[model samples]
Target chain A: MPLTSPDRTTGPLMVIGGAEDKLRKRTILKEFVSASGGADARIALIPTASSLGDEVVEVYDALFRRLGAGEVVPVRPQSREEAHDPDLVKAVGEATGVFMTGGNQLKLSAIICGTPLGDAIVEAHERGAVVGGTSAGASIQSSHMVAFGVGGATPKQRMTQVAAGLGLVKSAVIDQHFDQRNRYGRLLMIVAQSPQLLGIGVDEDTCALITVEEDADEVPHEVLRVIGRGSVTIFDPASIVSNAHEAKRSSPLLASGVLLHVLPAGAAYDLTTRTLVPQPAAIDPEDAAELAEAQRDMRQLARDIAAADASPAALRRRLARTRTKIGPNPDPLEGPVS
Target chain B: MPLTSPDRTTGPLMVIGGAEDKLRKRTILKEFVSASGGADARIALIPTASSLGDEVVEVYDALFRRLGAGEVVPVRPQSREEAHDPDLVKAVGEATGVFMTGGNQLKLSAIICGTPLGDAIVEAHERGAVVGGTSAGASIQSSHMVAFGVGGATPKQRMTQVAAGLGLVKSAVIDQHFDQRNRYGRLLMIVAQSPQLLGIGVDEDTCALITVEEDADEVPHEVLRVIGRGSVTIFDPASIVSNAHEAKRSSPLLASGVLLHVLPAGAAYDLTTRTLVPQPAAIDPEDAAELAEAQRDMRQLARDIAAADASPAALRRRLARTRTKIGPNPDPLEGPVS
Candidate 1:
C-alpha cells in the first residue's frame, strides 16, 4: 500500500459537509482516521478556512485525537510573511492526512497560492496523503472557486464570480452549502461560461471522498461517498451552443446546451465516465428497517411540533425561526440526537 | 459635432461608465444626441445584459429619437443559432456610436468573444465612437469583467476572476455597485493579484465620462465631470507588498499594499497624474452648512419621540427600528422633514 509508487493510487481525499456538532464530529473523525490508513496516521490541521483561529484548531485537534489520530498538528499562518515557513511546508509534505478547517476558502488561497507551502500541499496529495476540507475548504479544492453569486437555476452571464483556487482538482468547480443555499443557478452559470469544466455541488454535512485509480492507464480519479442527507448536483456542459459575437443583440445569458445530475446518498460517480451508479441494495433488510424507523420518528417530531397548543401565528413564527437556525433545509434524523 | 473622420480624436478610445442607462432611455436624450454628434449618429444597441426578457430596442429607439440620433438600429439575435447576422455586422460597421446595455456581461462575451460582431465592436471603438455600458455592460468594456465577490477590504489570491471582456479599455478592471456594496476588498484584491492593471470601482447613480483629448500630444483620454452624489474608488497596486503567499501560515487573508482614492461628487481624478482635483465643490456651502446644522434635528426627533409619553420599551423598540431603517451610518439631516 505504498502510495509513493507511480502506479499506486493515492489515498482518498475527503470533503466533509458542515454542522459538526459534538456527536457528529466524533463519527466524522472516526471515518477520517480509518480512511487515512489506520490509527497512527499523522494529520495536519489547516484552520485557514476558520480564520486561523486558535479556538477552532483546538476543537479540531481534540476531535481528531478522540478518533485515534496519532498526531494532529495545527498549522496556523499568521501573516503572508509566515505563510512561507519551511517547517510548515515540510510538515505537510510528510503528513498522512491534511485537514483544512472551515472559514474562508479565499483566505486559504491567499495564503498558500504560489508559495512553497502551497506547493508542499499539492506534493503531499500527489504522494497519497488524504486531503480534506470542510465548508470553504471544500470550495478551494476545485480549480475554479465560487467566489459569490445571486443563487438560482437561471444561468445568466456574470451571475457568478470565479476566483483563483487551490488547484486540488482541475476537472470541476466545487461549491459548498449546495442544496441548503440553493446554489444551482450559480453553478450552472459557471459551467455555461466555462463549458470545459464540470460543476460539483456538495450538500451540507456530506462528504465526497475522491480516490485516484491504481493504474496509470485509467483516468486519475474516482469519487467515493459517505453522503449525508441531501444530494450532490453535477453540471456537465460538454455540449454548448455559443457564438461569441452573435449573442450581442439578444440574451446571451440563455444557455442552449447543458446536462445536470443529482446524486443521492450512497451513490458513486465516476469522474471519467461522468455517470452515477447507485450502491447495491444488498444491505441486510433489518438495517434498512431500522433506518426507516428512525426516519419515521423524526417526521413524528415535526407533526408534534405543528399540532402543539401554541397559537397558529406564534407556531408559524417559531417554525420559521427554527428553520433558519438549522439552515435552509435540514434532515431532523440524519445524525444522532443531541 | 460629427463623430466621424473629420472630428475624431487621434487619441485612445474613451469608454463612458453609464452607457445604456443614460443613452438607451430618454433620461439624457439631449446629452446622448449631442455627445454622439448632431442628429445623424448611426447607433446600435447591444442589449446583451437585458437579453433574458423582451428586446429593449424600443427604449433605445425612443431615447435616440429624443436625443435626435438618426437611424437608431436594433440588432436581435434570436438564438445562439442566429448569432451570425450579416446585417448586424454591417450596421456596426457603419455606426458612429455603439451602446451596450446592462445585462449579463458574460453572455455578451460568450457570444461575441471571437465573432465578427465582436471584431466590429472592437474596430468601431478603435476607430473612435464612444463605447459605453451600465453594470454588466460597464463590466465588459474592460479587458476583464469582474463577475462578483463577497464585499470586503481583504486582498487574497484568486479572490477575483477575470472573464474575457470586450477589451475596449485595457487599463483597468471595472466593478459596479462599488461603495454601495462596500466592495473595496475585492477591488483591492484584484489590483494586488494583478498589479499591472488598475482597479476602478464605480458607484451607482454616477458615471465616469471619459473623453479622448485629441489636442493633447501626450496623454490620450481625459475624464470629464458630471458628478452626482455617489463616488468612485480607484485602487492602484503599484505600491503594494504582495508577499501574500508568505502570510498563509498565520492567516490566509492579507490586507496590505493597496492605494485607494475615493472620488466624491464634483471631484475628478487625473489617471495620468493620479491626483484628485476638486471642481469648486458643487454643493452650496450654505446648503452644506444647513445640512450640518440639521444634526441637532436628529437628536430633537429622538427626544420628541421619547417625550411623547409612549411605553418605554415600545418607544425604545420604535427608536431602534427607525435607526435601523435609517442605516448604520446615515446623514443626520436626511430624516423626516428634511
Candidate 2:
C-alpha cells in the first residue's frame, strides 16, 4: 500500500447496491451528493442501459437536485457513436460526480467499452470525481464483472458467468442487489474461479464507500465504510480451499475456508489487510474458550496457507481440503429463519 | 416462405433449455446427434462456458459415444487468444455437429464473441452442421441476448436489458430455464422494449428445432418445432401496446395484447407468419362462437396494426393500452402455491 500518498487526491468511489430508496429519505444518493462537493457538485448521468433514457434522466435529475446538487445534467449517447462525441467527453471531464442508471450492465459495456468518452470518465475519476451506480451500474464497476449469473444460495460450478467490465475496481468484483437476489452462491463461484480477487456482495439499499487514504509514508490504503440500511458481505477467495474446477459440471461445488466478513452499516474494513476494522469503543465479550479456539484456528490457517505448495490456483486445481480443520462447536450451516 | 429449396441441406439449430437428462433416456442430445448425420457425425464440443471443462467434455463425449456417434472431439480454448487459433477454427468449420456446454453464458461470449471461432461456428451451421447448446448455451443463440434483468411475475419498467448476441436467430430472443426461473416477466419486458422481435421462453429438458425451409416461391421461412418434455412459450409482442419506455424507472410496466402461445412437444411454429402451424392430424375446436371470437380478435389486431404508427418502439413511447382486449375472463393475479 502506498503510505497514504500525499499527492494523490482522487475522490472516493461510492458503489451503491441496488434498490436505494428514492421516495423516502434518499439516504444513499444524498451521501453520494454530499461527498461529491455538495451544492457545488456537477453530476453527469448515463442512462444508456435502459430503454427510457428520458424518463430515467428526469427521475435522477430531480432526486439529485432535491438532494442539493448544484447542477444535474444528463450525458446521453443516443448510439455507441455518440459515446465518442467531444462535447460529451468534455462534460464528463469537468463533472465532479457521475452516476449511471440501472438497466442492462452489458449495454453499458457495449457502448462504453472502447470509446473516447469512456476514457474521459476514467480520467475524471482518476482526478477527483466520485463515480456511482446501482444494480447493473454497480455490477459494471469491476474489471471482472458477473455479466449475468444464475440465482442460488448454494455454491455450484454453473452459478456464475463473468465478462469484461469497466475496470474501476481492479482488485474487487462488485455484486449489487446481493441479499435480495440471493447472489452469494454466484459470488462464491466467481471467487472460487479466481482466488486472487476479492468478492464484494452489496445488499439492497446498502452502499460501500471505498476511499483510498494515503498515509504519511504515501501508501494508499483503500478503506471501506458501510453506509445505508444493509451490510456488505466480503469474500476472500484467496483463503478458500476449493476444487470447483475439478468437480463435474453437474455436481455441487466443494469450497472450504473461504474467509468471510460481514460489515453492517456503520462498520468499516481494511481491504488490504482483509479484515474488519473494529468500530470505535466496540468491545469483545470475555469468552476465554471461544477466544482460545479462534487463536488456535488462526494459527493453523497461517501454517497451512504458508505451505510451499499452497498457491492461489492450487486450491481450485486440486481437491486438497484445508489442513485447518474446524474446531468443536462450529457455526450451524442453516441460519435462523423468520 | 421459401419455395421448397432442396439444394440447401443444412441441418437445423437445436436450442435446448436447462437440465436435459443424461442418466435416463438422453433424448435432447440424442436428437441433436441424429440430426447431425447420426453415427458418422463429427461432433465438436465447446465447453468454454463451463468452469469444469474437462468434466463437461467427458460427459458429452461419453454420451455421444454411447449414443453411437462415430467421432466426438473437444474444442478446448483456455483463453480468448486461443479462440482465434487456426486449428480450433478449422475444427469448428468442419464439424457435422457442435455443442456448447452449460455454465456461464458470458464466458462463452467472452471467449467466442468476436473471435474467428465464433464466425467459423456460424459458417459450419450454414453449411449443414447442427449446432446445439444447453442452458447458457441456449440463451446466446439470438441476435439480441437478455443480458440480465430483475425477477418478478408482474412486469416492471426495469425488468429487462438487452445486448448484442450471437445472431443465430436474427428476429428472435431466447430465454433458458424459462419456467424454472420464472422468467416470463423478464422476457415480457424484453419484448415490450422491442415489439418487433419475437420472445421465446424455453423450459428445462426442452429443445426447439429451428430450421429455415423454402416454399415453392423460393423465400426462406423459419419454422420452430418443439421436442423433449416441457413446453416452449412464444410471445409475439408486435401487437402489444406498451408503456415501458415512457414510464419512470420505479414504475411498474404496462403492456397489453402481447400474443402468447405455449406449445408442447410435437408442436410447430411458423416464425415468418407469426402463427402456430397445425400438427399433422390435429383438428380445430367445434365451438363456433369461440372460433368467431378468435377470428374477430385477429382481424381487429391486423386493422389496428395497419393503421400507421404501430412500430415496435411506438408501444414504448406512449401508454397506448392494447385495443384488442382479452376475451372472456382473465385469471386472478395471485397464483397457487405448492
Candidate 3:
C-alpha cells in the first residue's frame, strides 16, 4: 500500500470523544470553529446520529454562535430518503464546516452512510471545509466503525461487531469513551481479528484532530494531534501476532506485540508512518512570559514568608506593604532583598 | 531537570519482563549477550534477588557461555554484609556486563540497594558496561520501583506500594509481567499518586532496551526501544488529573488524561521528552532483499497456478518441469509467461 493515499481530503477533521466540555473550556469546539475560518465559519450541524430531536441541534447551534461562527445550518436527515434530499446536499456543500453530534453510531451510518448528503460532506471536505464530530460522530469518521461491544482488557472472540464508517480517516477503527468506559478490550479484539487496521480509542472530552501535512518529500501525510482534557490511544498492529483467526467463541485471543501509543494534548502522530512527530522547538511566547512572571511572584512570596517568620497574617501584611512601596507598575523581583 | 542527567550512567540497560523464554529462539538473551560485547564479554551475574541458590546463577552461566560469552562471575550476596564485600565489589567492577536475576524485588533492594557491590555495578555502568536484568531486575533499574501490587484496570487507593530503585531510569517506576498479570491498575495507581513519575509496564518475554543518542541540537536523549515477543507500556502522567491524595481505602482514584504508550519491538520512545520517537527512514538491506525475493516467488507461484488451471498436483508437476528446463540456479521469474 502507498504510504500516502489520495483517498483522503484536504480539509481538517475534529474527531472528538463524548461529553466534550460545553460549559467550561470548549477548547475542542473552539478549535473546530477556528479551523473552519474563525468568525466567517458557516457550519452545517448534522444531528442525525443524535436520537434527541431539535434540542441536540439547538445546543450545538448556540455553542457555534457563541464561539463566533458566522452561521449554523441544521441538516437533520431522519431517514435514508431524507438523506438523499438535494437541498440537504447543497447545504452541506456550501458549509465551511460540517459537524456530527453524539448518539447511536449505527443509526447515523444507516441513515447517511451512502446517501447524497454523505457524498456532499465528503466533497466539501475535499474543497477545504472542516469536518468535526463527537462520540458516535467520532466513530463514523473511520473506515470501520464499532457497532457495539463489550468492555474489558483481554481480546475475546465475538466480543464486538463492526460497521462501515465514512472512510475519512482510512484503515482505522475508532471507539469513543475509551478508558472511561473500559472499551480497551473491544478495540483490541477488533484490531486483533483484523491486524491490518489501526485501532484508535479516544477518551471522553478529547479530540483526535487530524490534518494533512506535507513532509520533506512533499508527500501529504495525515497527522493526528490530541486536544482537550483526555488522551487518544492508538493500537498499531502492523507487527502483531494473534490467535484471533482460530480462537473459539468467547475465548481470549492472544494479541501479543501490538504497538500502542497514548497521546495527550500537544502530541502529534503521523498516520502514514504510524510514528509520533516531534513537537516544535519554540515555546509559545505568551506562555513563556506568564511562566517567568509566575516565577518572579513565587520568589517574592517566599522572601516575604521568610521575613514574616512563617505567619500567614504577617506575610499577607508584608506583601501589602511591599505592593504599596513598589507602586502600580512594580516588578515583584524588585522587592526588598531581605 | 536536564534532558540528559549525569546521574544516569553511560551503559545500556536490557530491562526484561519476567518469564523470558530460555529455550526456543532466546532472542532477548541473545541480544543481551551481543550487547555485552559478544565473545569478549565477562558478565557479572547477581542472583541476590532469587530465593533459590546456585541454580539461578547456573541457568544464566550456561546460557551466556552457550551464547559465546567469555566468562560469567557470580556476584550472589545473601545479606547486606555480603553485599559490602570488597571481593564481590571488585568482581562486579571488573565485569563487562552486570545482570540481575528475577525474584523478590524488595529482598533485592534490602541486600544491595546501598551496598559496595551495588555501587560497583553503578560504576561499571558508568564506565560503559552493559547492565541487564529480568523481572525484579527490571524494577530495580528505575528510580521508583513497585514492591508489590494488586491487579485491575481502575486505579484505586492503596492498590500498590513503591520502593527506591538504583535510579538508572530517572523519575520512572517499572513493573514486570504487566498485562499478563493484570498489573495496569497498580502501575496506574503509582503514577496517579506521583504524577511526576513515568510508569512503565513490561509484558512477559519482552525487554525494554534503553540507549542514549545525541540529537541535532547536541542534546543527548535516552531512548527506550522495545525488543522480544511482547511490548513495553508507558504511562506518562505529565498532564494527569488525579484524586489519589484524598481517595479513601480501595476507592477508585481519578486518573484522567494520563498519556499511555504500548510499544512493540522496533518501536522507540524518547525517555527525556516522554514522547514516541520516529523510526529511521531506511529499511534494512537484508529485509528489502528478502521482501523482493518473496514477491517474485509469490508472483511465479500465481502464474504457475493459472497455467495449471487451479490444480495443485498439476501446478507441482509444472514447477518441476520448469525447474528442469531452466537448469539449476534459475530465476523463478524466468518461467514460461503462461
Candidate 4:
C-alpha cells in the first residue's frame, strides 16, 4: 500500500539535512521563500530546536531580510501554554512559510507535539503553507523522529532511539547529517524495526523535496526530488526478510532484499513507481571530445614547456601561453571567454 | 556500463555471513560441498584467518566429514613463503571447494596475497571451483579489504582503513560481521573514497552466493542468491551523491541516493540488471489465514492458562485443552496434528 496522502492543499516539504548553505547559496531557504509566494511572502522562523535562542533568530532574521522576505517573524514559545499564545498562533496561521532550526530532535518533538503552535503549523500546512526544517528540524517533521542515540552501521538493539514528532510526513523517517554522521545504520535499524516506514537518510546540505500529488486510487502519490550538493540514501524495507526477531539483543541485524535507492542531484524519485525517474544522460559526445582534445593539447603544451624550463613558475607561464593558442571551440558556449 | 567481466572461468563465489550452522542443515556449508561436486568432492580448509588454528581445522574437518564430503584436508602456513608449499598448492588444485575460516581479515589477506597457495586458489577458481569464506575469511576475499578500524555509525577518514586483498572480487568491498559490529559505516567510507566499488555488508549467518555466469559481451553476468537465516546488505555507491571529497575530514559524510539491497534466504539479485529477481511471495492466503487464527487462539489460550495457573506445567496443560476448543484450521495442512 502507498503512503496515505496529506490533504490536497498541504504545501510540499523542503526537508533539509543539516549544515545548509546559510551563507552562500541558501538554495533551500530561497525555495522556502518561493514556496511561501516569493520575497514579499510572510514567513515565520521557529528557533525552538536551537539552544542558541536569540543569536539563532537574529541570524535567520538577517538572512530572510537579505533574501527580501517582506514579513519575517521570529517565534519562540517557552511552553505549550505560550505555544497557544494567540499572537504566536496568529503569526503561524498568517504565515506562508514556517522554518524550523536545527538542534536536539527530542527537544523539538517534545515542544511541538500537542502544542497549539504545532496544531497551528499543521493547519497552516493544510492551508498550503510550505514547512521546512534543517537537521533536528528535519527529523522532527517525520512521524517517528529519531530522538537521540549512539551511531553504528549495523542494526543492533538499542543502537537508536525514536520518539513521536509533528508527523508532517507520514510514510517516511528522515535523518539529517546522514553520511557525515554515519547515520545510515541508525536509520536502517529504525526501518528494520518499522518496515512500514521508508528510511530517508539525507546528507548534509541536501534537500529531500517531498511533493504530494492527487492520490491515484488507494495509492498515495508523493514525489521526492533530491536537491543540493549531497545525496539522499533511502532504505525501503517493505520486502525485507530477517531474523531480527530471533536474534540476540546484541546480534547484528539480518535483513534481506531491502530495496535501496540513491538519488543524486538532477534526480527525481516517484514513490508510486518505486523507481528513480530515468533522465537521459546529460554528457554530450561533442563536449567529451572537446575535453579529451583539450587534455591532449594541454599535455603537449606541458611537454614543450618542460623542454624549455622545468620550474613550477615556468610551467605556469607556458600554461598561460597555450590557453590562447588553442584553436576556436566548436560550440560558441565552449569558446574561450576572451 | 556494467561490471567488467573477468576473462576466466572464475567459479561463482559463495560469501557467507558469520555463524553459519555447522551442525544441522548446514545449508551454506553443504552448498559449498555440493558446489565442489557432491560427496566425492575434495575440499581444502585454510585456517590461517582463524586464531583458533588447529581447533578451527578440527571443527570444519569434522563438519565436512559429517556432511559426507570426501577428502577434507587442513592447511596452515605461518608465513607468505610457507604459503608457497607445493603440497598446499596440490591440495587446492585437487579441491572443488577451498574454504577460509573466520578470524582477523587482515591476517588472512596478509598471509594469502602473492603466495603460491593464493595463486593456486585463484587458478582453482578459474577452473570452476567454489571459494567460500565466513567472517574475517569473507572480508579477505575482496580486492580492498577493511583493515582494523573503530566501530561507529558515522563515516570518518580513519574510522575505516582499507588494505589490498587477494582481488578475488574486484567491484565490491566486503565487510564481515557487518550487522553485528556495526560495520556499515566502514564499508560506506570505503565506497565514498572509491565510488566505483560496491560495499557488500554480509549479515551474520547469511550467504551472498555471487555466481559469475558466462559473460555475454562486455557485461559481466553475476547472480547473487542469499542463503541462511540472515540477509545481506549491499551498498552500491555507483549513483551516490556524497561530499566526501569536499567536506572537511571530521565533517559528517554527505551521500545521497546510494543503492542498497538486503537479500534474504532464497532471494536473488542480478548484478547486470542492478535489480532483484522478483519472486512470488511464499505464504499463501490460506496459510496466512490459518496462522492468524492460530495466533488468535494462542492468545486466548494464554489468557486461559494465566487465569487457571501461572506455572509452566499448568500452562502446558491449558494449551493442550484449548487446541480442541479453537475452531477448525483454515487449511488441512495447518490443522492440529491430533
| Structural similarity to truth (TM-score) of each candidate | 0.42, 0.43, 0.52, 0.61
lDDT of 4 by residue, A1-338 (tens): 65444566778888899998988998877777777787668988999988998999998888887887887898897666778788999999999999999998787777777888999888887788889999998998888889887665556556788898888887778898886676766787788788888888887888988887654375556778888876777787887655554445554564555766655555677765556655555455776786677677666655766666557777667657756787432433343222
Q: What C-alpha RMSD separates each model from the true structure?
A: 27.4, 25.0, 11.9, 10.7
List pairs with backbone clashes in candidate 3. A260-B262
Against the native chain B, each candidate's TM-score is 0.69, 0.79, 0.83, 0.80
Total clashes for model 4: 23
Task: Note the DockQ of each predicted structure.
Answer: 0.01, 0.02, 0.05, 0.20
User: Candidate 3's error at A316, in angstroms?
Assistant: 38
Q: In candidate 3 chain A, where is summed lDDT lowest over 10 consecutive residues? A: A329-338
Interface RMSD of 2: 17.1
lDDT of 2 by residue, B1-338 (tens): 22233225556888898899888988898998897778889999999888998998999999999888888889988788999899999889889999988887777887887899998888887788898999878888887887777654335567677876687877789988875676756787788778778888887898989998776787777888888766677777775555555544544444454555556566677777767665554334544455566666566555556654656666533324443454342222221211
**Residue A203 Cα positional deviation in candidate 1, in Å, after optimal superposition:** 0.7
lDDT of 1 at B330: 51
Mind giving the per-residue lDDT tens digits that candidate 1 earns over A129-191? 888888887888788888777654334456678987777766679987775565655676677
Ten contiguous residues with the weakest lDDT in model 4 chain B: B329-338
lDDT, candidate 2, residue B177? 80
Q: What order do you get sorting by TM-score, best first?
A: 4, 3, 2, 1
Q: Write the per-residue lDDT of candidate 4 for residues B133-236, one digit (tens) a residue.
A: 99887888888888878665445555768888877777678887776676766777788878988788887778889886554564556778888876677877
Provide interface RMSD per model, one decimal: 18.6, 17.1, 7.9, 5.5
- All models: lDDT? 0.63, 0.74, 0.82, 0.76
Q: After superposition, how far is residue A204 of candidate 1 from its true place, in Å?
A: 0.6
